[model samples]
Target chain A: MSFNPFYILPELILTAGGILVLLAGLSTRKWEAPGKIKPYSPEALALLTLTGALASSLALLWRPEVVKGVSQFGDMIAVDPMAVFFKIVVLACSIFVVFLAADYFQGIRVHRGEFYALLIFATLAASFLSAATDLIMIYLSLEFLSITSYVLVGWLKQDPRSNEASVKYFLYGAVAAAVMVYGMSIFYGLAATTDIAAIHSKLVSYPPDGSPTHIIFLGLLMMMVGFGFKISMAPFHQWAPDTYEGAPTPVTAFLSVASKAAGFAVVLRVLVSVFTPGVVDWTPMIVALSGLTMTVGNLTALPQCNIKRMLAYSSIAQAGYLLLGVAALRLSPLALPAVMLYLFIYLFMNMGAFAVVTMVSARLNSDDIREYSGLAKRSPASAVAMAIFMLSLAGIPPAAGFVGKFYLFAAALQSGDKTLLYLAILAIANTVISVYYYMNVVRYMYFAKPKSDTPLKPSFAMNMVVGFAAAATIIMLISPEPFIQMAKHSAALLTGTP
Target chain B: MIPLEWYLGLSAALFCIGIFAVLSRRNAIGILMGIELMLNAANINLVALARYMHPHILTGQVFAIFIMTVAAAEAAVGLAIVISVYRNAEHINIDKITTMKW
Candidate 1:
């Protein structure tokens, strides 16, 4: 028997991380030993475990490029450039989130080990969701992610807000997901296949536009609705700001960046693999949904005062922008790269924003915008980091966010969808509106007066992590060739075009 | 024996009911239950359609099985969250638990 072990690197790293946390919970002896079952000082122990996991994920950077369409487990996984690229992104994101989580758990009553374990497990599931080529695999993987996240969201069980955030999240998430499954069943009924590729092949010539199209259209719409709820797109995005605010900051960061990206990952897969050459008649509906989502998310965000809530609404709006890329799947020269590129830039811009939120909140014990008044006077490096993230998010010049939006709008334009292109331009206008709220923080940080004896110290860890994110944003803006090329290559796997 | 349209109609009705509950339910657990019913409806549709449309194919059955597994996992996490809510607020009614209600 031959051993085929090449495609398991990312999974192995994640599994090892999860097991390490579990073992740490089991093996550690304690000075006071709070409880025999509940590990003592689990925070420090969990932090170390997260560090180890982060290191393992970084280890993937050394592996050779994985081409697309390298299937495993009866065509369960498609280990192409797209999958490999996203796996790395998810992996790297988990590592950063773990760094942010340890502090957030300081006073929380949960076992830190379990939190880290759940984090690893969720990331692993997300990776699976991203790489899954079969419907069964996608559903299974998404379950793994959802369950872990449900627990993580409510990790601070003592806090009513935390519990409420989680409950609302679960209920809404469940409904959308069930709807998605129902839609999938419709596809299964029509195509008689659970493999995405098989279903796509079956769909290709089944009378391009007819009653079948209507039925398939309904199914696809239901499916995207479910995915939309997951990513917290507007109309379906009611749960995000609450959940992001109620969850611990680290968990919020992970949920916003990695989890949303993971969901988008599958959205790409569904569009590219199962509805290749585009779900023609379905495009108009998506464009309209995308337009409404972007417009509503940004417009609502204008009145938010809570920092976390602002970011939450902003994230929803960002998902709308990402949706524009998805809507262009059939319209452009290959929209997959556009999607990948946006996600890549999103990891930096969004995470940097969350990192600033986490760090500032950790020190100030608040998530209110007013609390961030005079951050620049208090902490220069952190202040500057916040500035760059704001600029990037607003899609200002010399930010990766600008380049990403440009590419996506360009794709829509090339797809010859004048309406979508106009919506994309209006999306840019929303970006301008977003700039105001984002800059409000910058203004308070630089202009307002500090109000506390709170020591404003930027440590090596904060500098290293935030600066790394900031530096990445800068590099992607100045010279995004390598990364865009990587995204383009990943795009090829889905579009079947080089 | 029930006709295949009966099963499809029944499944569609169940799904519609699920959607209605999700839209109207105030309690978080109640909403989750609605979602569960909807998923079960999907499973029924998949099995019925598989048996009728492609009598020889097992794909729909397999898909239905996956849906069930996912639903089970979802319930586990969801119930745990309900317990978490009760612990925090001393209330099981999601309507009263507005502290974190978004």
Candidate 2:
């Protein structure tokens, strides 16, 4: 019944930064000369906001109080360690994304402070999505996230591809959202409460479990339709390739990594927290969907020439692995940790891949795989980073992706679900299919010669993001222990185990 | 003086109409309007159930408010994207916007 504003410090910081950037945009410095030096300007404002968000999220590490479920806004926003941990992850990824966006906007002449403001606004929505424990809150935050993304995907309004991406994304997403809300109403009609914990209690204490199960599953299924659109899971993934390929590269990275991660975060939280496995009649259906999604994503990815579209399919494939984790949600000690770990690892690997795409495109002014024909000779840093991202995405050994996938399959194995094991294997084979396409990019970077002149210089921010994400991708392979430990600790909170 | 089943039936019929709109309309904005109708059906159901069941008045109102907020946000983003696309392609048709086709 009380509001603890401090519990939401990271989101508060980001939202405040959004406001500051909005106000700062109106007060541009004017100079008598053509190009005079204006200190404390655009770059400083963006970097300052990014730094503030990072510091606030990092501050969450020491707040042991919130780890134990400190409620704020009448328990509407929870500040548990799970939320805090993912907030840190989201903040780190957002900071990296904004850094890339800074470079991207400068290059593309979209240096409006509104771009920074929207990035912050989107991050705010992501944080809310992470912390929501009620259907009302989740729906609102999801909309917040979607609208911001719709704008960001269409940031370059003059480009036909950008406009098309935004329109398609918005239309598909609007239908999904409606379906999701109807699903929520179904649950409310059956259970009489929207709070996740209350709904769980209602179901657990209900007389006829079958009746409640039917109603709740309908709600969950409808909700999945919405989230499936967001995360680009198969059958619902028809929007992904177009949107990802058409959006700006920086926004593409955000869409693939942060936005998709946020979508899974909501799915995991709602499914694991509200509806136990017994309540839902379709863990196998989920497992089957996982199998189909990975296979479809990889098989389609193998034959693509446009690098961005290939990555789009590849992202869908990654969504399958996350779906496997969702199917294995209630399986074992490893179940929750595996999903948390995969999401965390995916942040590094996926964003790194987009960084490579962005870097190559910036240098070559093309997103065609052929443009990467001689990246090794021109920019070995990007080439090696691209290779690492590709290998990691393919679930190659000695990388975080492999470790994450192993934990997921091991959890499925622990659950003793034969169908899920089949999914795990199919996912592995899809990884192999993915390897061919990923290596094609690598082959283009190393083997074939560039069809045109390669750039002599890489943008400093691109260099920073690539190097940072590449290092994280490798380092998590070595000391994945600490991150894994944190993930386990966080997941245990949901199960009330640790 | 409509019976409860009739009210529920009307809302369900409205929901079906909304689904029909979504399936048939090629204009992105028209599809968005369909989505709005579907949400409104769900809202109608909420109010009906509240009126019939009468277990809690506050929860239904809160839900209605939340749905409105979601509908508003959806409309804003949906229409903005539609206008942006119309400006670019000079048409509101979803069929012609298949540049990313396989």
Candidate 3:
């Protein structure tokens, strides 16, 4: 097979960009005070790198060959509309996170340069993860993402909370990755190939029988445990709240959006491609897991006093909702697109929520919900944006989250399966229960009187990011035709003429 | 040649022990060692399967190599985080490292 460097242009750029940014961090400025090293303006360089990569991904989308999903490098990586779409998502995430961190690090008094380098590296890993077509590619990319995440989570080395979070995250992640690799080894052993397509064909040719049934099930479950940890699915979600609360808020935002997107991308691709629908059906299992995950996530979130922890739990619930689409993928053609659309909208609303958290925390140096009291009186703009985000998260109309949920529930109902319908109803009940906790933040921001009436002022760049995300969220809700159409097209690339 | 089943059985037993050590151990370094054991179990499976099933191809061996490389990297990072955590708390007990909780 001929190697095509053009197929991996985006990844190459990101890799070069990460190294360059790392080098930039090492170079000292001439005007620095004694004993103080002037940090390089990595935020600007990171933004430039991310934009270039994003442009390349968009260019790849326009290529006719890539539209049809071209396999490159001995079928290890796939270049398709779906891959390009996710690359775009992850790149956008990097851009916004860099924006968040650019302003955030100034407030916290931490080293800013290597932080961008790590973020870029994480983006590179996520792009590979969404495009991996072979078992080796999948495992390598997934581990790359995990290892970077472990470091990034602990970047605030001086903070005990941050260090603690990193340890917990690393311990859980290392074990989960080990279990997942074990499962992949089994598949490779049975099929004598590590390529996902080849494994699918082999499994289809010789389906597992009585004795091997246990191995297949065990393999699938173990692998899901690893993916579940990345996406923060329940029963495997013990690390998320702690990690999110302990880590720097900007890192939390990046993990919540881009990392989760990569996890969903791999989960959707592997389960859809490998299992072939009936050989070893895991939909019923997923349905039950989704229900349990959402219920647990919402119920646990209600008692959280820390805003970051609350958002963490809410993100788990959102993952449960996303999994519902995975459950409906075989039954409804719209499921995958709905999932894609939901993730896109989720990036804005959830990231916007975290952006607000970063801003408030930077000022008050607290992540507690009560610290947001009378935020509307202090910062009307941020207060309104937070309200919109909270409402969007609650799936109220005129916010993009409602439209996202509508399509997802529509997919579930279109399945016409009694169990799926019940799952949809359960999701609706979870949504209603979620409204109270989401609104709890809004209540603190609007109704409660502040201990002091000092006005809060977000920086110019922070305002720009929050405004852009808020406007996009409302605009997507009001006119979702283009975004919905794009998601459907991307979904079709994965599910074959969906 | 020894049966592939024998190799697989040993790997499975090793993996189980690894998991037990990871879950049961309280020291951070002990947990990391457990993770290494689990990774090596997978490495054993990969190498054994490659030799028995596909003697002509080197995919499984290559995968085993990559797993070894990744395990080393993970251990490096894991120990670094452990050392950093210890700097703050003066201890490395996993159970006692609870500064942030629900």
Candidate 4:
């Protein structure tokens, strides 16, 4: 249980940054006038903090000793390439969200400091979630993330919709978390240890007949209910569309990408580490989940008129595709890398789409699809970027999403398992169904007549974020070699291979 | 001393009751109460398992303590959100807070 202070520099930076931002905000509250202090002042501080955290995380990538898998502080937090990869993703997503949020929150009249502080805290929790190896660490980090997110969803305190969204999210999140803890308790009872690897070793040492297989199965199932809720998988996905639509758009974007990434991280860690092959056959269950998730998500998205709700379903569908990798984990070597690569690509394209929606909604004050009519004529650059994002999300050629989907399908097919192959085909069909709705957004932007001919102008900061995302998606599509290599390296820690 | 199975059974029953309450209750605070019950069920399991199964190591007891702390934090946030909802909608029933439909 050797503690290394330097090992968790990024988390330290975020915690300190959050406290400082809180104090800064409270001190500023004494001013009499609302517009006396510009909102950008706090936003710049947030951006600075996020930039520092990202830099620290990136610095960790270059440290060879840290890159080699080692559990920090007595196996509670694992400092490995896999954790580093997800932390980088979380930090980068927060940075991008801050940029987009700086522009979004400029119009809102809330206490800006708390919002940024909570966002940073959520990021810290997410990083902890990806790295957590002990059950206590996992539960604490998850609750930390959830608590911050609940407040962020209702940050627009005056908006009734925000209030509704937060209440629903709080209720669902609390129940799911409680269910997950119950499962953890069962795990502890079975193994008499809270360390995940220790539990796995105990399970392995005790023969299947000797151990309580039924209780283990029940616990794992209950835990999946919580993870599934976080990732917005079907049957646990009822809260997503409403939450996405009602919460602030930047929060929606954060939830869609960073939060989902953390969910997948925890799921992968637990399933691969604790529930290894030959111990329990959970693949069939994952296969069923994948099939239902993609189909339900794609089909439900078809009738949605709100852009946020449609994207919410699209993200759920994306989660199904990611789960295909998890399902094929035992059969294919490419499974972990495929999931990792997809999340990286998902960060850019999905965030790009939501940022465009934010821009449009800001201009028209509507999230309705009809308001996007002739968006090309109104904002050509944004419309073009939106189309590219739509194409990428639909898994069309020459988009990064196509490459991500390609690897997942290839991984599933290469496994040569009958069920996995069938899942791959089902995913392909879902991809086609998804295109209709994604392209519908594009159609409204390109083909539909405008209700008003007023030209929309996005802020300079927004254009930069959108442009960067679109370009990254295209670049990754064109040359996925670097990202593929990185993904493979990051995933090697989990797969236990070079 | 009583067998561990009895304690486990009692906690399991409590957890089920909590789940039932969470699903059946229309009031927001009632659902929160259900969540607390479920959490306490886990806590009981943790402490009883530690006492019966692994007397030397207090990991389960420690876990129970952490769970209690976390449950307190969760209840605080849950109640705060409920109050905000009440202020906005003039009621805490889950049914009345449906501003955003699925």
Q: Pick by DockQ: which candidate is best?
A: 3
lDDT of 4 by residue, A1-498 (tens): 577777788899999988888877775552323332254466667777888888887888888887677778789999888898899899889988887776676556778778888999999999999999999999999999999999999888778998888988888999999999999999998899999999988887877578777788899998998888888888898888888998999999999999999999999999998888746779999999999999999999999999999999999999999999999988898999999999999999999999999988877889999899999999999999999999999999978999999999999999999999899999999999999999999999999999988899888888999999999999999999999999998887787831
Q: What is the TM-score of chain B alone in each candidate?
A: 0.88, 0.92, 0.97, 0.97
Q: How close to the true structure is residue A14 of candidate 1, measured as C-alpha lDDT?
A: 70
Q: Any idea how many clashes model 4 has?
A: 0
Instruction: Summarize candidate 3's per-residue lDDT along A200-274 as a digit string, tens digits.
Output: 777777644533656677888988988998999888999999999998988999889999999999999888888
- lDDT winner between candidates 1 and 2: 2
Q: Chain B TM-score of model 1, please?
A: 0.88
DockQ of 2: 0.75
Alpha-carbon TM-score of each model against the true structure: 0.93, 0.95, 0.97, 0.97
Clashes of each: 3, 0, 0, 0
User: Where does model 4 exceed 4 Å of error?
Assistant: A27-40
Give the lDDT of residue A108 in candidate 3.
Answer: 54
lDDT values of the candidates?
0.78, 0.80, 0.89, 0.89
Least accurate 10 contiguous residues by lDDT in model 2 chain A: A29-38
Any idea how many clashes model 2 has? 0
